[model samples]
Each structure stands twice: as C-alpha cells, then as structure tokens.
Target chain A: MPNASEPPTTSPGIVRRFWWRSGQRTRLAVACAGVLGALAVTGAAGFSGDARLAERGGPGVAVHRGDSFEVTVRAVSGVDLFEGVEPGTGRVFGARVAGVSAAPCWQSQSLAVAENLLRGKKVRLIVKKDGDTGTDRLLVDVELPDGTDYARTVVDEGTASADVAARGELGPVESAARLQRRGLWAGGCTGYRDDALAPPSSTPQTSSTTAVPTTTTTTPPPVPTTTTEEPAPEPPPTATEEPGDDEWLARFEGKRCLLEGTRRTSPKGTEIVCTRGPRGQLRWQRAD
Target chain B: MRTEDHVDLFAEAVEADPAPTRVDGGRPRGLTAEGWVRTTGWLQVGDHPVSSVLLAAVAGLLWALVGAAALVTEFPVAAGVLTLTTPVVSGVLWWLFTTRLRPASTARNVDTCRADELEPGDTIRLHGSIGPIGQVVEVALDDDARVVLHGGARRTWARDDVVHLAELLR
Candidate 1:
C-alpha cells in the first residue's frame, strides 16, 4: 500500500507497537488502574472538593425551604441533634427535640439514650418557625419512622422532662414516667416542673421534692404552682400602681411617680410614696 | 507477492531512506500546555483517534456528573457510585492519552530510524520514551549503543531500548 517514491512508514518501536497490538481488555484495565490511582492520590492529598466537603461533615445550616425535611442523625449532644458542645461550624444545624428538656441531673445519660435511639436513623424534621429565630437553634419535632415523636419517647423513657416553655402534651407522659420510677426518675431527678418551683440552683437539685412547696417563705411565690394543670398564668399585674388621677381625678393612685422617694398626700389623707416595687418599676405605693 | 517483494515490503515498513539534512525533527523545541494537551487529550492515548477539543468537552461532561452527585444529597446510591468512580476513570483515560495511547497515534509524524543507523552529529530525542517532546542532542554510536548529551552529561542508551530514534521537532 506504500508508494516506493515516498519515505517508509515509521514504526512506533517494538514496545509501543506491541502495546498497539494488545487486546482491548488489557488496555482498558491499565487505563482503569492509572485513573483510579490518580483519583485516590488526589483525594488523599485533599485536592478534591468532594473530599473536603465530606471531611467537614455536611453544612452548619440545613439548606431547606419548607416547614419540614428529612435527615439521618450523625450525632446527638445533650438534647440537641447534630450540635457539638461548641457553637456552629462542622455541624448540620442545631436542632433540639421540641417539648422536652434533657434532665439536667442525668444529661450524660440522656445524651446516651438519644444517641442510641437516633444515631444513623432517618427522621422527619418538622421545623417550628415561631419557635426559631431563623439563625440559631431550630425547634423541630424529630419524628421517627412510625410517626412517634422522639422527644415524647425521651420523656417516656425518663431521660428528659416535659418543658412547659416548648409546645407539646408531654406533661402527663413525664408525670407517668416519674410515677412509674423509670430511668432518671427512679432516682427522683429534678423535672422541669420541680425546677420551676425551686429556681435558684443552676444545676438540678436532686434533693428537691414536694416538700419545696411547704417552704413558701424561702420559695418565691411568683412561680405558678398550677403550671402542671394549666398553661402558666400571665405574669401577675405588677403592684407598682400608678397614681389614680388619670383614671379618676378624685384619687392620686395608679399615676406615674414624679420622682423616686418623693412623698405625696392623697385627698383622703392617706400618705403615698414613690418607690421601686418588687418588679423594679418606680411607682406610688401606700406609705401607711 | 514474491518472497523478495515481501522482504522489500517488510524492510520498507521498518526503515526510511536516510536523507541528508532532514528538514524536520532535527532541532530542539519549546513545550507548551496547548502542545501537551494536543499530544495527551482526545482519544490520543486510546485506539480511537478523536480531536482533543472533542474529548475535552466529554471530560467536562463527566466532571459535571461527578460534581452533581457530590453536591446533591438526594441522589441515589447509583449516583454515589458514579461520583466515586468517574474521576479515577477520567484520570486513567488521561494517563493513557499522555503515555501510551497518544504516542501510538502520533509516533509516525516525526522522522525516525533504527537506533543502529544513527550517525555522529545526527540530532535525536534524548530519551526514547514517548512523553513531552524532550531535549534533542546529537548522538554518536558507541559499540552497540547510542550516546547523547543529557542534562550536560553524556549518557549511552542500549540500542534495544532506543530501538527507534527521532528528533524533537516542536
């Protein structure tokens, strides 16, 4: 097929020529080995974006638009899902199970319960928009596969207590767990209801019991005792009554005080003084 | 064809007539990214001969598939496998292009002769392996080997390894 007048067709040399004649499978295998090795080297060297993203372990903020999404639990810290002890960074958004607070006295044990129950399990996340600030911790009802509320389960398991501050009907479940002497409740751990009764201690007081209600003198009376039966009552109307002149010109009560420590005599001859009330609001109080 | 004709045919297939002062493949050249890509990309390293530009577009597509799989969590297990494998496969394809496949395609483009036929003062590729067009130095015969200047040092290559010799043209 070659013209004698034209120069010879150059051979690619023995090895290359032999390679050229090699079977398709051998060439393909060699190609695969080289490529896979290069990728593994690149990943090991930290050059790939995928490797970087995986190392970071997902995003700090959950990128979702709707009221709910789904996620597999990566970790559990205290009562929050995917939240490390430190704030933000290398986390998949801070989420706390709605309606339950981890029992302060048994926080480590509660974390263990949560980790055992939720780790690597897929759960439906129902975001509570009203409970969230849109930036920080998101209030979510973590629902397991069978539509069971994870927070309620924790409360039932006695690892966590029902929180009046969060929305849920978990008070009765917590009460039942305590009455049955389950989990932390077996040792009479302080529940959220008990914490409200004796508010001074930052750590849950293990010795706190029904006897706390009898020590009303040492206990602040402002705490709503009916919190278990009803929603907490509105903060009692502050007793710092304004001078009444605005309501009825006949009396100088329920009116703002002119100056703190100032004293005035009412039309009925009752003495009133401007002083700071229990709520720190400077107002008129009967000096009698 | 007769036996003599077969012999002539085989000889012609292997060796080119020595021309005095071959116009090309006799001088040193500069390396560039574009030149490297041309020699390494496309189906240059494979049995398939395709334009490097076309192959680059295909590689870009593969990268997109891989990137999408990595970024989107909703993607299924198949997508995960695709993300894990595409890069290595692409790398292998590239390696094949640069080292083995591309050379097979473009080898005949340069002036070549059996290493035993090389004369003194005849410039040839410093190393016999197909790679970035390397240094071109004048070679001299030393017994059964070809001697060439490499990195300011004279090194001799066995004629068997340097079975065929060519000079860097570009």
Candidate 2:
C-alpha cells in the first residue's frame, strides 16, 4: 500500500493516472468509431444489389456532381480516395479520381500506380456533372500538387486509358502509350488496345456523326442563295467576302455588341450590321 | 494541544520559511518547486470528466443501435435520418462536454507566488480548462499578465490565476 501524503510518482501511480485518463480517451475513441462505423454500414447497404447503381444518381461518397474542391489522398482504390472540406459550407466530402478509364484487368496495377503517385499527397478535383460509367461514382479531374494531371499521367504510363469523351486532350498521350505498348496497351487488354489503333475521330461518333450530315446538306444551298440575292445591294462587303465573313457578320446582327472596350446599345430597337473592308478593318453599321 | 493552537504553530512555521524548500534530499524527483505533480484528477492536464466520457459513449452507442435497427426493419428512410443526424449528435455532445461537464477548480489551498518573483518567459499553468502548460510572455507592473499557450495562441489572465510558475525541466 502507498502512503497517502506521498506524491503518486511510481509505476503504480502512472497506471492509476492512465486509468483515470482512459475514461475520456475511450469516449473520444468510441465517438469516432461510432460515426465511422455508421458511415461504413450505410455505405455498404447503399451499394448493395441493384440499389448500388441507383445510388450513383445520388450524392457521391466524397463529392456531388459539379463540386470542385481540394482533397488529400487517404487511400487508393481503383481511383484515389481523397477527403476535403467543401468550401463556403465547410462540409466534409470525399472525391475519387476522375477522367481515367482503367480496365478491369488493370485495376489493381492502376491502384498501385495511384498509391505510388498520390498517397498522402494533396490534389485538386474538379467534379464533372455527368457521373462516371461506374454507378454513382463521381467523375473528377485529379490534379497533383505541382499541377500534373492525374488522368493524363495514368494514360501516359499505360496504367489506364484516356476517357476520350470526358478528357479529349489526353487522346494524343493515350496514342503514345499504345504505340509504346505501356500499361493495358501491352497486348493483353483487347478493348483499350484496339481503341489505341483506331483514329481519335472515332471516339466522338455520337456528336460528330450527326453534325456532319446536317451541315453538308444545309450549308451549300444558303451560300449560293445569299450571294445571288444580296450581290448588288451589298457590293462593297461582298467584294471582300473573305470566305465566311457574311455568316460571321450575320451571327451578331441583332445581338448587343462590344467593340474596343465600348458597349454599343441601340435605343431604337435597331440591329448592328458589321462588315469587313478590303483591308480587314471592321465597319459597324446601325440598321433599324 | 487545541486544534486552533496547532494551526497557529503551523502558520508561524510557514511564515518563517517563505521560500519553498526541497523535499527529501536534492529536489523531489517529480514535484516541481511550484508544486505541480504529474497525475490525473479534476485539474489534470487534458483530462475530461469521467461523466462526460460516459455521456459521449452513450450517445455513440445509441446512434449505432438506432442505425442498425433502421437497417433491420428495411426502413431506408429511418437509416437516412440517422445518418444525417450523426454529425449533429456528435457536435451537441462535444458542446455539452465543453460547456457543462468541464470541472471547476475548488482547490482552497492553491499555491501562489508573487508576480515579481516570476520573470517573462517563465512556464506556468492556469487554474481552469485552459490547462496543459503555457509560457509567460509578459508580466506588467500592475499585475496585468499575458501568456502564450498552445500553438502560440496568446491569452490574458489575472495575477491570481497564475497558480504555478517554474522553469520547465529539459
């Protein structure tokens, strides 16, 4: 037994002090564990079965659609797991890496690459409004500390393929990776490997295919009709057509105009008709 | 001897030796000259009351139990409600601990030293929840004082609250 008056400084004293301190420490630990466990349970349940795909339409694990925030990588999944407090609201959110398409076979290696390059490092994410192909996963462009593009790096190293529809600028880098047989391009991953050999134009098929036929059918007839009808009245401007100047002037005819740091407003409900002279100087004409 | 007579004798002895003396031989191993001892109590460094800890634990366990029940009953709506309430519940518990459950100092025998005896840059501990070590940044002639505590955050306190002042042992 210890003396009552003596200061408790022995090993037993230290143990007693720790025991008293444990109450507060245990409370803090339980609080944190409780919250985290709740999140884990809910997250698991949310992603269960067919509801997993539907949950993608809801807010993401770390971010919502169109959220731009800075995050630090906590763990690496197929994409990096990042956490940051949302600006203006101070609400905490997690964000996964966006704009890279890692094939299923290459996910583990891609995750390894993400860990090697981004683990415990700060990165900025610009969340895209369109959700990822993976149900409910946020699409974000992960930028490294020194402004290196995470998706471009992944594609350049052949760890993942460039998401052409989402990240068009990475097409050239993806081609380079394929030519060098890097990453998934190394002959075994058939889907992305074949994509590398196809022309970059093939990826924009949805928009480009529709646009090409419409423009070809409608554009030629209008040019001849406009040239013939307006030839005499608009001689000075038509003489210096300069290819598409007529269409260019026509686009802004009825719009509010800004020129040389001046706002040009028409009080009489008039249109600003613009023309290019022979020397390429712009002439603004007001028409009511 | 009568109890009053014994108290008078002890008071006279204390006044005779105003300066603190070392105990045992060369300064007691853990007790500072200012009388700070490393231990957990109502006034210990970074210690929360056991009651506060119990309160937080109960709150957490309640959240977990309700969340589990919501999942079991196939009540996604209830689960969602519980999920949204978790942070608010934790924040309320933290506020309760800080504002209501924190201990107050009732120590009648609080040791004190004169402001003149302590110089600028002396380490000290305040008497309240602002515990856990601070350095005296300034000491004014009129008993006005300033201390730089945790993370260079400065605070002002009266001369009476300056409970312990001593050189920090390296």
Candidate 3:
C-alpha cells in the first residue's frame, strides 16, 4: 500500500500528464506554423507580380497595366481596396475608386456596404488612369441583380464622400443623404459643414473681427482725454494709464460680449479698475 | 435475549465479517452514502462531450495549410493578410479565455464536499470579503458561526457565504 503522504499511482494523474504534454506540443506547432506561413506568403509575393514590375521599371511602375476587365472583389481595406482586379496573371491589384473619400468614422460601414454589394460577385472594372503614385485608379460601376448602382449606392448612403476630386456625378445623391441625415451624415461627420465652409487657414482671422470694433471705440475716448490733460502735470500718469488700458482690453479680445459698460479708473496708481467682468458681463457703476 | 441485545449482537457480527459488505460500517471506504450516490451518477466523457485542446490544434493546422495553399496559388495579398491577422485574433482570444472567460474547475472528487458536512482536519476554499482563496483549519457551529482558517485567523461567515468545501481525498 502507498504511504498516505505520497501521491497515489492513479490513472487520472497519468491522463492529466498526457494532456499537458500534448498541449505544449500543440502550442509549439502553432508557433512554428505561423512563422512558416508568414515566410511562405512573403516569398510568394516577392517572386511574382509587383516585385517583378518594380524591378523592371525602377520600383514604382503600375503592376496591372490593362484598363477594362472583369474581376471579383477579393477583400476590402477602407478606401485603398475599393475593387480588387485579378488580371489572370495570378496577381491581384488593389484599385482605389477614382473619386471617393470615405471618412475614418465611416470606413467600416463603407467596407461592409462594398462587401455586401460585391464580395464573391463578378463586376466590370473600368480603370480610369494610373493614380498619382502610379497604381491603378478604377471606376467601378456595377449594377446589382436588383439594379442598384454600386458606386452611387455607397455615395447615396453617406458612407463615402463624393467631393473627392469629382470623377463622377455622385454629388446630388450625397447631398440628399446629408439632408435626410442618413448613415454617416447623422452626426458622424459633426462640424463637417463648418469645416468645409471655412478652411483651416482662414479661421484665425475671423476672431480678429471682434477686435476691430473694440479698438475703434476705445481709441476715440483716450485720444480726447489725453489732449485735455496734456497741460496738467498729470501727463505721466495719464500716459501710463492709456497703454495699461489697451493691454487690459486685449485680454478679452476673442470672448463673447454679453454686456458693455463705461470704463472707470481708481485714484491710486496701483490699481487700474474696469467695469468688465471676466465672463464678459458688465458690472453697473453708481453715478459720481 | 432482549430485543436491543439481539440487534447489538447482529451489528457486531456484521462488523467482524472479513468481506467488504455494504452498510457493514458507518460508511464504506470513508465515503458518505450521498457521496456514493453522486459518484454513480457522474457523467461519462462519451455521454456528455467537452471540447478538447487537441481539436483546436488540428483546426489551427488546417487553417495554416489553407493559407499556405492560397500563397502558392498567387493570392499572396489575401494569404499575407490572413497570416498577419490570425496571430492578433488568436492573441485576443487567448487573453479572453485566460483572463475573462476561464471555465471553473470541474474536478468533482476535489470540489464536492458541503459546508455543513465539514469535519475537523477538513480543508475548504472560501470566497468572501477576506479574499477569494481560503483554507479552513477548524470550524465552530455555535450561535456565532465562525471558522478558524489555516493561518490561525478566525473569520465569521454566514452559511450561504461559505460556498465551497474542499474535498479531502485519501
């Protein structure tokens, strides 16, 4: 009989040990397969299409040369792979739509819409021209079995923007979607209209509009007061007060003016008083 | 003989028997009658199947083979995409299973003792305010229900709070 403190020679313990050893072997095999698979993919790609094209024409030439062909959509990767055209050379070329910009927030939805419309289905691809980077830019116009225009459908559903270099007449469809607040137009592209109306470069000068009126109004009062006090020995204090007042008013330049009030000054030279509060509201002053 | 004396004589005779007769002792092989009943009702592997890690490993190998075939057939982009994404997806699944969705241990012989049935020298795994893992040293069933843990630290627990009692396997 086995000692009570020692473990029993149980069948369950043997089964557990076998499973543990098998689990370790499985993990090692999976890791090795992953590495080998990655290497095989890279080696295959290097020996075929794009690498050959790159070597022939200084590393940036178009791999897929033909214009019009029938191809199937293999995969969707945001705006990059709008259509995947396989030109029978066993190489797949990713084709971006000639004019469409799917915003980041709408990318997944756009991909889903594209996949639903074209995945595993044959479609006619009309390559417009080589894009800026010499890759094929295609104009994919496919009618679904139910007669839905694929490219126009994506634009009309507000998933992709039509204002990307204007290659097709998708503006009207996009406009209608924006008005109806459908898809990404429904708060996804927040401030898109404002951003489009006022370009980034011109935004800072718009704040200067408020500064113009405040400077014009305050300059007239100081000029008259300075001239009247010019004969008095109080010219030094009045001169200092004018510059300080301008500096103080400059701090509230871009803020909204909730109220406006007359300016007041303190008797002591230490504090220059103003009726304006930090929140742009004017505190009322009693008559002297 | 009296009726009680006759019953005692029969019980002594049964205990003195050399054969391992059922119900001769208080419990056969130190197992309670309730425990024996549960053991008989244990689900066999064939009756109620569970997933094996070996099956998952085989599936992974098949997936890798498919990916390799795609690469050789000149669908390198598709194959490459799958190869890159598989590890990331697998890592996420591994994290989910290990950290968030770990299945509780189902070793019935180790986890089948009830709290009320705990005796002296019986160890238990407690889950409560003190911590998730605990071992019982001694138990008191007085008005103030308390247990003396392995560290000589005494803790009071409601009957329901003492959820698991560790099985003392011989």
Candidate 4:
C-alpha cells in the first residue's frame, strides 16, 4: 500500500501526471468502499432472500389449461440400488424450475418436445436412463395455479411415477422410451465414449436433407433480443437510493405528474425532451 | 477586430448595461484571482434561494462528479475535465441565474427633442420588458437624428413602436 506522505514515487513524466491528475488514492479508496458497501447490501438481502420450495412435477403433473411453457424438475444423478431408489424414480431432492430454466433446458435436451409440446400448455420430456439415481436427474412440466392461463411456475412438486427404459441415448428418458416403442428413436448414445452420455446413434432429426433453410431462418430474431437483455440492468428495484447527483430530482420530488409520455415537463413549466434520464426518480402530482 | 472581438463586444454591452453588477460566479463573491475583491454586501447572491440552489448544484455536481469518477475509474481525464469545466459551467450557470432572477434595469425613451432636454451620456428610465429581460445596447441616432433604441439581439426600434409608452408619458 502506498502511503500519502510518500508522494507516490513512480515513472516520472506522463505516467506520474496521469496518476496525480486522476486522484489515484482517493478514487481507488472510494471505489473499494463502494464495492464493500455493495457486498454488505447483498449479504443483507440474502437473509431476506425468498427461496422457493419446489415440488417435483410427476407423470400426472397437471399442465395449465391454456398458453404454453416448459417446466423442468431434476430426476436423478447416480443410481441407488442399495437404497431401493429406482434408476429414474424414488425421492428426489426438489429444485424448482420455472419458466426461466424450463425453456432453455427443454430446447437443449429435447428439440422435438421443444418444438411440438412447447406450443401447447403442457410440455413433457423424458430421456433414457443415463447412469444412476444420484448422478442423473429427471425434469418435469407442471401446471400453475391449478387451472392455469399460462403463468410462470417457480416451485412445483409431484410423485416420481415415470417409465424406466434401456440406458440407450441421453435424450429424455420417457421421450426416448416412447421413441423406443416406435423404433423411430435415432440419436441415443454419443459414439466411442465411456461416459454415460448418449449411445451410438444417428441424429434424432428427421428430414435432415433440407438443413439449409431451417437453420437460416430460426437463428437471428431472438439473438439480438436475448443478447441486449443479458446486460446487468440498473436495478429495476421498486425503491431507489435517495436523490443522488441529479439536480432536477428536487423539481419533481413529491410532485404528481402526468408525463405526456412524449416529454417530461418540469414543475416550473420547462418542458424537457429527453429519453436517457433525469437520472433519478421524479415524484409527481399526476394531472388528472 | 481580433477573433475575440465578438466576445469583447458582448462584454462591453453587458458591462455598459450594469458594470458594477456583473459578478463572476466561478470565484467567491469577494475572492477573485487578485484576492478579496470586496462586495458592498447589499446585493449578496445568497439573498435569492433560487440562485443559491443553482450555484450549489453547479459547483457541487461538477466537483462531486470529479470525485465520483476519480473514485470509480481513477482516470486522469476526469480531474482535467472537471478543472476545465468549473469556470465555463460557472459562467453559464450564473447567466442562467441572472436571466431568471435579476430585475431589469430602467432606461428612458422620449421623442421630444429640446436643446436642453436629454443630455448626452445621461441615464434614462424606459418602461418595457426590454430593460428587464434584455440588456440595452448603445443608443444611436440615424441621419434624421431620430432616437433609435438598440437591444441585446441587435433589434432597433424607433419611438413609433412605443404607442402607449410615448403617449402615456406625454
């Protein structure tokens, strides 16, 4: 650590000028203090953090009445023969999968189910047995609010009464099982691998010849929306830190406003046309 | 005229309007580069709450930003930017403050031309938003010797523009 009295010995010319002008110690100290303060806030929030107790979605997992989405409940990881916990059944420690985790996991694991079942209110995906109950986990889709009009589910639970099939492919156990019944299942295990992934099998895709047009069309639209949305948002928190650098905050604080939706008007009759920010919350007295 | 002649003209125009009143908002009321440029303390800027708020905001915001930036990124340019901005922002802010707060100075305009009536270099009271909202440029006389009023925006108007102002005082 450099001391204040030491005068910050460094490479003399431009480098030294840069550090001095930058208020090196002051800035670093402030930044560190801010980070530490944020960490403290996070810890405080953890105590208040609500952890949803998810119920595993079972075979009879009720799908919502209308509007479609995916739900995933971890099935198993390692087989527990000694404990009588079946390869794909028995008590599974539940981790709730809501609309957030459902859509992605479904698309990645079961493309067919993702395409077809995802369009309906209820989506179910099952792959062949991977290894054991402890190592491999099952995912389930469940209805929300009993008779649902498509709402997001956070924590869902159900009984594990699912079909057990050959340890063939790494696709959804129940799905691969159904595919087994039809003899149409293609991709199962990945070739020449000891690890319990998929078996030696062809790609699950049917009509693989016209790969050009389908790949071309589906990739672009969602990428931009998803990429732009991924950045750390400036906290959409309902309550905000009180009045920071923005001077105009005072002008609107505790005042109701009917923002023309076109422009923000100041209390003193100054119409400010801007979209970026007043940089803080403006209290307003809504005009009607 | 030099490149700064336009600025010099503005300075002169404003200075002519009220020389003793144009206080630099950057430095303290009394403290100039020369140090302790005293004020009479009558028209202290603190009298207006709005002006004080504008002053505090302009100064504190700039400095606090410098402080925050130095705290966050620790870039060399932050301080440099702040130093260059202090005076410029202060001047602009002061202009804003005064434009809204300062009462317009009075100037007189009369059409009657008597030999002993209106003395040269004499200050006169004029009734209008002109003296209050904008500064008065130097008074000029055209070829006909008709008195013409010059305003801040370079607009020249004769006594004909003032129907009520001339007739009411008549």
Which candidate gets the maximum DockQ versus the true structure? 1
Best by lDDT: 1
Q: After superposition, how far is residue A268 of candidate 3 from its true place, in Å?
A: 69
Error of 1 at A270 (Å): 56
Residue A152 local lDDT, model 3: 72
lDDT of each: 0.47, 0.46, 0.41, 0.27
Ranking by TM-score: 1, 2, 3, 4
Q: Model 3 Cα RMSD, Å?
A: 28.5
What's the true lDDT of residue B38 in model 1? 17
lDDT for position A263 in model 4: 39
lDDT of 4 by residue, A1-288 (tens): 111110111223553334323432453565456545644554444322211111221221222223233333233221110111112322322212222222212222333222211222222322222222223233322332234311121101000102222211213332322222211111222111112223113323212221223223332112111123233233233332222324444544354221222234332344433232364422343223
Clashing pairs in 3: none
Ranking by DockQ: 1, 2, 3, 4
TM per candidate comes to 0.39, 0.29, 0.29, 0.18
Candidate 2 wrong stretches, greater than 4 Å: A1-66, A80-92, A130-136, A188-192, A196-288, B1-170
- In model 2, residue pairs whose N, Cα or C atoms come closer than 3 Å (at least 3 residues apart or on different chains), thus clashing, are A56-A136, A62-A94, A158-A183
True contacts kept of each: 0.00, 0.00, 0.00, 0.00
Candidate order (lDDT): 1, 2, 3, 4
Positional deviation of B51 in candidate 2, in angstroms?
35
lDDT of model 2, residue A164: 76
| Candidate 4 CAPRI assessment class | incorrect
